[model samples]
Target: MSSIPELLAVTNLNELSINDFIALLLTVADKTDLHPALKEGLPEYFSGGEKLREMAGNLRQLRDAAATGNREAKAEKMAAWEAGKLAVAMNAQHLTMLSLHRKDPSLLNNIGLELKQRQQGGKSSVNVLAETPVVTAKHVQGPSGPVSGSIVVVISRAKNTIPFEMQMTDDPSNESSWSSQGIHQKSRIEYQELEPAKRLYFRVRYHIDGKTSQWSPTANIIVL
Candidate 1:
């Protein structure tokens, strides 16, 4: 019988002789260091490490069978390989998220925002709502009367801290022209009595702790 190390050195699939398979099996068995009773329970072909060697021979036979154009065997091996790769990728992603969260606790919040955006059809799931842009004659009467139009916007956040002062802008260059609104934990906003017949643009600004985030994408509302 060839030594365990000799078996591990056999790299050529085409040259996998019976002795080579047995050697490979011995290598695997030696590495596992199974209990004596468990080792004894194995068939004579595997006794003292022969069992593993036989298994290696069987594996080579399967491989040869696959090479001989057994589509099913080839597919099975391919599926196993893909599954192993997927498992590795999932593990990598989990580790990455753990590391990122440790470095920046706010990463979870960002991930939540991404998930919400996906759920909301790829456009920003966050919205801002309001009544009509037209300052209808009825709305001019005051806040007490029924508002003819209302606007509502929704924003998504993973964290408990809500954004401060969501805003709207007609143009990106005119920062001072932006209008402000209060953000709620529910990620929604309502603006009543918007002026009629105007082209209005809206954006959201949020802060975590004291650090402020950039504005959300601007949405345009045309009030009749």
Candidate 2:
């Protein structure tokens, strides 16, 4: 754990393997500028949020180079990405922590984070592990008053769990149809911009001390 609540205490790059979590960190950092109360006390880490988005862009470039066999750029892009991915994620987290201290911690929900979390030095769970994670969720409202089409996914976590992945698919029959929502550090994640009135399927899997769990059973919800 970090000595200061404002500091993010991640020790390894793998802790931020999911670009979604990086994305989540960005959502909080960038939105602070719009939060009337928080805009006045923005933390320096939000600057890291800008850098994180750039890192994500580089990651996509690396993927493109790898996919198209653009050998000339792969090494260059990969090296730069490796040099900054963890810093970007951790810095965003660190800055958000400081911002939270200046405002209501409840803002965590507004930013898609659950207030209760454990991976960061909280008490460890001792129950025997399930073979796969079980996912549950509720839809969130839009800013104006109607349904927002956002899904807040929740999962039970064990002490061994490090981070988890969330994915969605409309065609469950096709193995190749699944689209990833990216990696998230916490179990309670929000799914955004889903098509209305369509059946959406979701699943989760966890990474432990370098091992991965089997994918969870499908959990489906009909968008409002």
Candidate 3:
């Protein structure tokens, strides 16, 4: 067994949630200040920060669209956010790994990474076939608010969990009509400002480790 610590391989940074990815960026950036060792890779080390911020900006557009119930704009913004996030994270991972490469792996502590002691001959990683978690329509609650288009999907949660991506569409038959409702850490999510009297559809999905689950079974509710 190798007594030396090694960086925990986060080979799929794209699988991280946006907020988690941001946290990782903050960690590495902060660590640079404490580690004079990073001086050589300093400039390049921070290069991905700008892209991270831009991806965050794209995320804000998604948030705004979801809040106002502009489903079409929400879809567009979600697409932009996803693409930007993937690109930024992939680039940052490459740069961060390069900066830390060949350095003391103990430096990984508190840098949004875990350190694992290396084995002389590591066991081959096993491929676990990840099954998609199932989600039911659960319950669709009619609007209690005075608003004409407010509706709530009362999803019961067992406890605290990562955000489940919510998506909606006015027409289930139309593939292009689906739009993001943004992510909700809570199980119960409410969507408002929907077009009145329209039959809308909803679904949920989440990512863990390196796998993304298939979209949940579709749920439908008519906007009041």
Candidate 4:
């Protein structure tokens, strides 16, 4: 049995291995006092039997791809694995929030908000918690080489006063380290500065009532 501290030590989901995620699933499964929502959803997301094995198999394939230097295969597996991990982590967070509120119903909304903020710490799972903004950009020939056309970002969640951030990167693989153009309150914007033949990657994040969403999937445009 791993100590609570050891499991809780996972500050970043990106740093967690497949095995660690499996162990977390097992831990959650063993808890008898889970909230009704978690109890119902646990089997689909984190069953100690078949679902666990399937995830392990996926991780194995990912490992094999990495060993063989298959970048595309590795990337696909990585994205799938990341998506699964986020789904599971989201459940765990919900369970934590449920547990806290069970002790005192007055702590419901505020605790939920706090747990949400903690979940967003990874940024990868921000979209899971908040609305994922769809972003698009286009590059066109201009007076000076090439320039980006309209950059539009949109999200239609139930919440209001959504904030957003636009980010750009030169390489698709380096989207994790993209530079932010700055935060914006609107869903659409246009800025035209691009170099010819250069491929630009773009993504956007929306904020729901001060909570930042996970960055949207990346969109790219090649300068003419």
Candidate 5:
């Protein structure tokens, strides 16, 4: 049996056939209990495959439509392509979780919990700008009445100076509405005076040197 990392690399290459992909998915799903690494990564791992399959289906449809030069079909295919890209991203995240699980099972619970909270907290809905590196707020606490505490953003890449832009958001989809911080140095972003009982959303976009990096999964902070 291929090791999980090997399988992940294969998936990354997009070389696996549909049947092979499905088989791997089934293997991961069925044998998660046996592999401690997989077990630890289960939450993220399991969530990825269906999305991959959906993306594959979309690509197939798009290819066919393109060959036929059907305008309406092309438009639909483009939409599917966009959705598929998101699905592939979710799968990539699962792969990252798996990698972390192999390094330390103890982190599995913590990482899983973080991922779950982010999903619940509305960060997952944000558009990921790139795969180079990502920063996300793990937790935020403010004063009892009207003070925003420190904002923590997790960086996925090797530690380095990653420039980021962050601004408050109410509409997650309105990326433009988010004010940019203008290439600040650091992975985590912070703001103050965000009052209690108010819901604050933030859109963060970051880059290294010139290449674009992953944006923070849209994060919401509620002061209490």
Candidate 6:
């Protein structure tokens, strides 16, 4: 355990050094359960740190608040903690966008569609799909040959019937490596064909009223 003086030494948010920022993110990544897409992409943003001692110490305040038996204070602290976790996720997304934009500006296009939609005069659609959709894949026969089969998307909390897109990739580590299969009305798409012994990875995104959600966590299948 680090001493109080050591923990207090962490740079404040406004004064965060590059190392400190990385440390903070690394710490959060280790401690919290995050959206699967964020979980897979965030680690590449920073490297060479196992923990953020100062941030860890700060989290102890949450524990203390919970122990105090003050309902209001505990609720407030927990809410702040939840907000902080979200901030981390959003921050990671921003950094990734910047990097992708630098490599290929078009890659960042539609990356923050939901946020952009909110800024563009408010939500145009009554439906809001904030949660990342989960996708699955299966192998089946096609008219021409064997296909990677179709992708099935499940959006658990969607309020409206909306169009969804499928992104296919062979390299999971490279976000830019994906090829979009475009949008469709139904929840399933059967357009992808695969060679024998090849693997296909799939992710789905919802698009409604000119806005889209981030791609979901990947699902994969092998063509027999």
The lDDT values for all models are: 0.40, 0.56, 0.51, 0.50, 0.44, 0.48
Off by over 4 Å in 3: 1-86, 98-147, 156-160
Where model 4 places Cα greater than 4 Å from the true spot, the runs are 1-128, 139-160, 208-210
lDDT of candidate 6 over 185-208, digit per residue (tens): 565555443456767787776654
Residue-by-residue lDDT tens digits, candidate 2, 19-132: 443344444444434445444544654443355556655665565465466886768756765556545455447545656676755443333232334334323321222356
Instruction: Give the range where candidate 1 is weakest over 10 consecutive residues by summed lDDT.
Output: 129-138
lDDT of 4 by residue, 13-34 (tens): 5665543443333333333233
Candidate 5 residue lDDT tens string, 51-157: 44455545555545554768887787667555544444454456555556667534333121123333323332233324445545544544654334444545454
Report how far residue 81 has shifted in candidate 1, in Å: 64
Q: Which segments of candidate 1 are over 4 A away from where they belong?
A: 1-148, 159-161
**Candidate 2 positional error at 44, Å:** 31
Candidate 5 residue spans exceeding 4 A from truth: 1-132, 138-156
Model 3 over residues 35-127: C-alpha lDDT tens digits?
544455455524344554555556655655665778887787668656654554444455446547755444444343333332121232111
Candidate 5 TM-score to native? 0.33
Instruction: Provide the global lDDT of candidate 3 against the true structure.
Output: 0.51
Clashing residue pairs, backbone N/CA/C < 3 A, model 2: none
- TM-score, model 3 to reference: 0.48
Worst 10 residues of 5 by lDDT: 110-119
TM-score of each model, in listed order: 0.31, 0.41, 0.48, 0.37, 0.33, 0.39
* C-alpha-based local distance difference test score of model 2: 0.56
For TM-score, candidate 2 versus 4, the one ahead is 2
* Alpha carbon deviation, residue 79, candidate 6 (Å): 45
Deviation (Å) of 197 in candidate 6? 0.6
